[model samples]
Target: MYAAVEETVQARLILSPHRSVRLRTVLSYLPEDPFAVSMAFPAEFSLDEAEDERSAEDIVWVFARQLLSSGLELPAGLGDVHVRPTVGRRTMVELRAPEGTALLRFDTTDLRRFLWRSRLLVPEGEEHLHLDADRALAQLLG
Candidate 1:
């Protein structure tokens, strides 16, 4: 059987030091996709205010699970997505796209709790056992 973990967390879109927007973010992980985690934002939310339209569907960013874990303790990631710890029990996640960059601030406790719950489903170092390499290879080959 496969299991998935989803946690809803409150976050702040850091528009500026004084200006910010509150956002409801969903963090999710599935044992089937063992090595990755996903962050989904509301459809109404626009990463780029200057864009012509707000996406009708939720925006989800998928990245390595280990990157998030490492980020909890120190800065991690290189391009498109980056995660790092911040002052006052907060974590900063930077998402970069052609439209613009979105700087999100989340509570460290919330992220930690989410990660812990995901680990219960697919523990660290055991992801390889759950992965379907043949299926992945087939998808890539296609």
Candidate 2:
């Protein structure tokens, strides 16, 4: 059995080929769109703990695989996905592309609930981490 953490709702943006600048410009122009035009996570995905020491790189790789396999389309010929995990009170997962980087924050509470329901983890008390998916996406595109 693998030790799994709660799964959160993550948003991402698929960049156009060498169009990171254009994408950011368009996002800047459209300020009213709630749904950020970036990468988005599909319904099914999970992260499993590594057998060795838990490094930040390990975590990012796990997250990148989940995001890529979550039915989100990427730009043509894009390879070697780079992800940076911003560790803090609010953990931000940053996906780096040739043009720019997309950031995703985890909804700790909702993810916990989902994990508990999925039997991935035992339910403790109520704790919450509100992840702003839209804002993160917007920032990514911007």
Candidate with top lDDT is 1
Model 1 misplacement above 4 A? 48-55
Q: How many Å off is the CA of 32 in candidate 1?
A: 0.8
TM-scores of the models, in the order given:
0.92, 0.25
Residue range 11-97, candidate 2, lDDT tens digits = 333334333211111111011221112233421221223323433321233222233222122221135343233334223334554
* lDDT of candidate model 2 versus the reference: 0.32
Q: What digit string (tens of lDDT, one per residue) describes model 1 on residues 25-85?
A: 9999999899999999986667566545544667899999999999989999999999999
Residue 83 CA displacement from its true place in model 2, Å: 8.1
The number of clashing residue pairs in each candidate reads 0, 4
Candidate 2 Cα errors over 4 Å, as ranges? 1-89, 120-142
Clashes of 2: 4
Local distance difference test scores for all models? 0.91, 0.32
Worst 10 contiguous positions by lDDT, candidate 1: 47-56
